[model samples]
Target chain A: MTALKAIDKTTINIEKIRADFPILSRKVNGKPLIYFDNGATAQKPQQVIDRIDHYYSYENANIHRGVHTLSRDITIGYENARAAIQKHLNAANPCEIIFTKGTTDAINLVASSFSKRFISKGDEIIVSVMEHHSNILPWQQVCEEKEAVLKVIPINDAGELVLDEYNKLLNEKTKIIAIAHVSNTLGTINPIKEIISAAHARNIPVLVDGAQAVPHLKVDVQELDCDFYCFSGHKVFGPTGIGVLYGKEKWLNQIPPYQVGGGTIKTVSFEKTEYADIPLKFEAGTPDIAGTLGLATAIDYINEIGLDAITTYEHELLVYATEKLQKLQGVKILGTAKEKAGVLSFIVEGIHPFDIGTILDQMGIAVRTGHHCTQPLVAYYRVPGTVRVSFAFYNTFEEINVFIKGLEKAIIMLK
Target chain B: MTIEETEQEIIDEFELFDDWMQKYEHLIELGKSLPIIDTKYKTDDKLIKGCQAQVWLHSELKDGKVIYTADSDAIITKGMVALMVRVLSNHTPDEIINAKLDFIDKIGLKQHLSPTRSNGLVSMIKQMKMDALAYKVKRE
Candidate 1:
């Protein structure tokens, strides 16, 4: 195993962090809950929950274009949340941040609008095999609609993308390069910096599916120079049905509106109707006001804890888990990439992943099982599915030990 | 023995195990002891869907009794199927069709089965009854 940097224990108070998430203390099936399903969705902190509650309890009002005082206050709060996200992503302007339902929604918006404007028949879109179905299906749909071709970048046995293969697939016909910043199944953090630069050299815009990346890393859209970056709120300890799609202002101005309705228009007459500017042009009708507030608060929570500290703590935890799991007999981890995030996928010999997950659940350990929305990747591995354990900064070394004990017991039972 | 009597017997057998580990060990032993289905019977038509594990179930009528043969890729699923076959097979078509097989709940396995596995179990039972009904109609 390659040596990992040791995290400073003083940087993060694990106990205090755990206290922020109330669900961590709950019991499942008479055992203490050991949540290792952060990849699926993270447990919310008290601050985010309270933020949502406070929004509905006091500041509940429809945002934008209202003359009432409550509406003005809510509109300010909602727009402030957008600015917060813009700052978090380090985008040049707050208008570059377009709020959507979630990561899937954000991807669909880009796939539909951008493809309609830029892609023509026989045009090609590049994607990686390691993408979640959200990233794959949208491009597939656009390809089908536009009669364009979808090219997939293959992966190595270690779950890292074959950069040579990716370069070979890219050509003059390649209109856009859509890929995941991190594989939710393999936890391989793709070199998005390299990917974006390569695509940019070809003058092809790259859209990064940052659903799994935003939770664990500090994302700077300007630094990566990605055309678009999108992520969900729920995966980062916020409420569901809220996400951000950060697009370059030039690209945003070029792409047409995905959905048209109440708030997304400038002037509507029997004649030609003018659309609203940049961000408002994309956001239509009433949005998830409470969810947006909660997401902003979640971002604030992460900022307070600090992404550097969180990244350090989670990296150490992943290394500890990988080392311990590798030492166990009959256990085979799926992804062995040199660089990875919090996801750990493995299968025990002579034991099915479902059975192992079931046994683990009985012991109050929560781990995701099955294809994890990456069926092609699972099929490539030649397994029905895998047992996935994803960690967050809130998780402790002690919790990992409990998970190891449960997993060992499960293996014995199945064997 | 009657189907109810067989179910009660199986429930009593499960009662001997205290912990989930011991119960699962008994299940693994039962799976190991299950009669293997002929390779020809393991086709796609006999496959049960919605299971996390692939399960193939086949049934035949012999001397007015319905006999079931099944296999699963997962051991626990195989064991569960084996228990079903042990309880429901080698019985009259009418008995096989109508039998409640309440022993799954009595043995504390119902709560333990995952939602998908429970659905698979239901599909397994349904397929056996459908086979019995076919045989019963042919006789009539």
Candidate 2:
């Protein structure tokens, strides 16, 4: 709630921010929660939670059809939320933003609908190896259906993508380039702006999975010039079951509607029906209106804090945790990209990630272990899986210290 | 000893731990002591892949008694499989099929029982029972 822009970025009031998340104060297993699983989902702040409650209590009505004041008022609020999201990503138009379930839903929408116009038999869908399965599977399904190929961009030992290989894979047969803005498992903030420009040169449209990126970084769709960008609200401290897909006006016009229901049509008849334009064309049925409101509130909450301050604070925490983990004997850090985010993945020599994760859980230190829905990435790394501790703006130096201590205890016991 | 006796023994053993850490350390010890599975049965088809861990179980009838052997990349899973072997192995198929193994909850390891945890321990347990059922059917 503190909008102290003049103050130092790193010194932005941690205590105030921590207080906003009610779950952070609670105990997990008789110990205060040390939530390092922000990559999985960020904890909801009181503001976002209250906004959802406020919407249901005050503005519970179906949108677009009703002439009642509740519907009209709430519809304005709903459109305002869309405009809020449009401004957040700096999309060309509010209609360019389509509300879906989450990042997975958004990607699925693009793959299914975008393919109707663009993809043909034997066309390739290029994705990086480090992408979460959300980014991979929808394209994989499309490829399977169309008899198209799913080409993968490779990564180096440091977990950074090999751009030379990506350039080689880009040919006329390439239909779409779907890549993650930030890797869910490795924390590698990919060079998406450069990738976008490269793809645009070839007239290939790119859809970015920004689920992990939006929580930590400021994403400007116009600035990046990505054809499509998708992100989940829940990952950025909003409610689940709500997300956004921002597509360029050109691409939106070309692609057909993904799902069809009552809310999407201009006029209906047995003979023929005209559909509404762009966003409403893609969005069908009753959308997650409450979730959308909570998402806007979550955006407002983050905007007050500023993404620059968050990026700086999180990077510092990442470095501190990385150095601490590096010092531990037999601890090997995964994904050592020069530019990374809050995610830290590691593996102990001769100890399973599950064992470490289980011990950490008992001590109330939450970390994600195993393939993390990026099994190909784990397979590429040749490790069983990784113990990933992803940080948020609310996580502190003290929690990191406790996590290291707990990790040492786990190592001792497991060894 | 009877399967119930073995279950009671495990519950009693876990009762000695003062804290969760000691209990987990003991679980690791049990994992280490699991009977080595035959190398031939360690293939991917035999593997029960969990979201977090993987478990491999193989059972064979020796003198009309089912002898279970298992291994896992994760030690906690190995320990649970080891515990499972202790209660179910070296018993007739009827005895194996009838055994409830509710002592897993009694030992405060109920977290593994939920399918959402992604450990595949639940599937392994079902596989053990299925193996027993097959053996029982063959005997008839």
Candidate 3:
């Protein structure tokens, strides 16, 4: 935190880490790749890529259905992935972890399954003003169907959650409280533990959207005491089409399955059907076998590198980016949360976010532009969209320098 | 040109693409050959809303035909604008409005475009159609 505590904005060394990612070695319009769009999805590590390749080449088979050698091996690999995720979130049981298509699907699963079983008319669902559309829309559907009310917790100008306002929103009627552990657009890290506690006092179940937070920080579900947690594999250093939903066993058992197909049933007949228990009940059809294996591999890779080291390094990069970007003329940095992840959202005066993104692209530096799937939040900020540059642990200070130089050229070109 | 003549010309020109790319050596060179608007046209008022590059577009219904003039701060975008002008210009507003440019795939333009760039192209094309529609409404 001291790196951010002191305002020392200097140049960064991008080439060193650029060598690690093979994609970054390529040319975009005759320039090397400088991808800063980690918030959208982080690039996969070599190990994760190889693991997926290995699965297809060697162990491709249907899981939990067949008795062949490949099937048994595939099932083991799949379950190992679940166990790895259990460790990642520090869940009480492996069965508590359910595989989903991605964070969006995972949140939708909770909204539909849990709400249908437990929620009633006049119940309320609490969400923050900073949530991505994925988090907001699903709960909104549930609220509409059940005739329940949806409430929002307002954020300060600095993008930090208004905890006092959040406390006021919680009441006996509040049945579910869903929030992003880290704001994707603003980089604000919410006080999830306190938020969860506030909801728990009212006996409300809380769900933490960890899509942005899980990749940057260490998330302990037991420590946060959140009833549900969901994150996508692609947001981390893993493959796409895979995500994790961690819920308490009691709740998982109480809720029905989101999708139904082959794997979810224990025994099926035209007359009657018996559904498989807990995690299997939620999973449904054939899962993304290779994606889960790749995710597990990514976890191993992260563990090998060490989470503490990654966080420390990312903190240093975030500070470096913030200080340097602020010094640029006419640049307005969007979020200044006391606690943040590795995100820098800004807009240059007289330059649209799209223009900034394109100019950067020409220099082989990539950053995400527009509302970033948080249009309501963008509307709330009264800006069309922001050019968001997010950092991964592998990104270096030198890359930041190249990005700054590219941005300066872009600004000059536009002005 | 009449809408029928313009379609025939487009068909004739598209048939010459193999020779063009062969002679030009790069697809971008062919893109650059398309006529472009002047720098004066590139303004905030004319700027395309979703492009990563600064793009300005203006369209006119001259003699019942749509004539599009556009420019961009970036080279690739300028090239894209030029290409769009070549395909869209000298055609009846109705024809231009109805025509779906399959030539975009032939040129492999979208592959070179980033997702935002692709979106910008869609927005620009949408704007052109809107202008054509507005013109039709005014005439009626």
Global lDDT scores for all candidate models: 0.91, 0.92, 0.80
> What lDDT tens digits, residue by residue, belong to model 2 across residues A56-126?
99899998879999999999989999999999999989999999999999999999988888888989999
Shift in Å, residue A45, candidate 1: 0.9
Show where candidate 3 strays beyond 4 Å.
A1-20, B1-91, B94-118, B126-140
lDDT of 3 at A209: 98
Can you rank all candidates by TM-score, best first?
2, 1, 3
Residue A175, candidate 1: how far off, in angstroms?
1.1
Looking at model 2, residue A390 earns an lDDT score of 96
Docking class of 2: high
Q: Tell me the DockQ of each model, to 2 decimals.
A: 0.57, 0.83, 0.14
* TM-score of each predicted structure versus truth: 0.94, 0.98, 0.83
**Reproduced native contacts, each prediction:** 0.52, 0.76, 0.08
Candidate 3 TM-score on chain B = 0.70
User: Per-residue alpha-carbon lDDT of model 2 for B89-122, expressed as tens digits?
Assistant: 9999999999989999999999989877568699
Clash number by candidate, in order: 0, 0, 7
Q: What's the candidate order when arranged by decreasing lDDT?
A: 2, 1, 3
**Interface quality of candidate 3 as DockQ:** 0.14
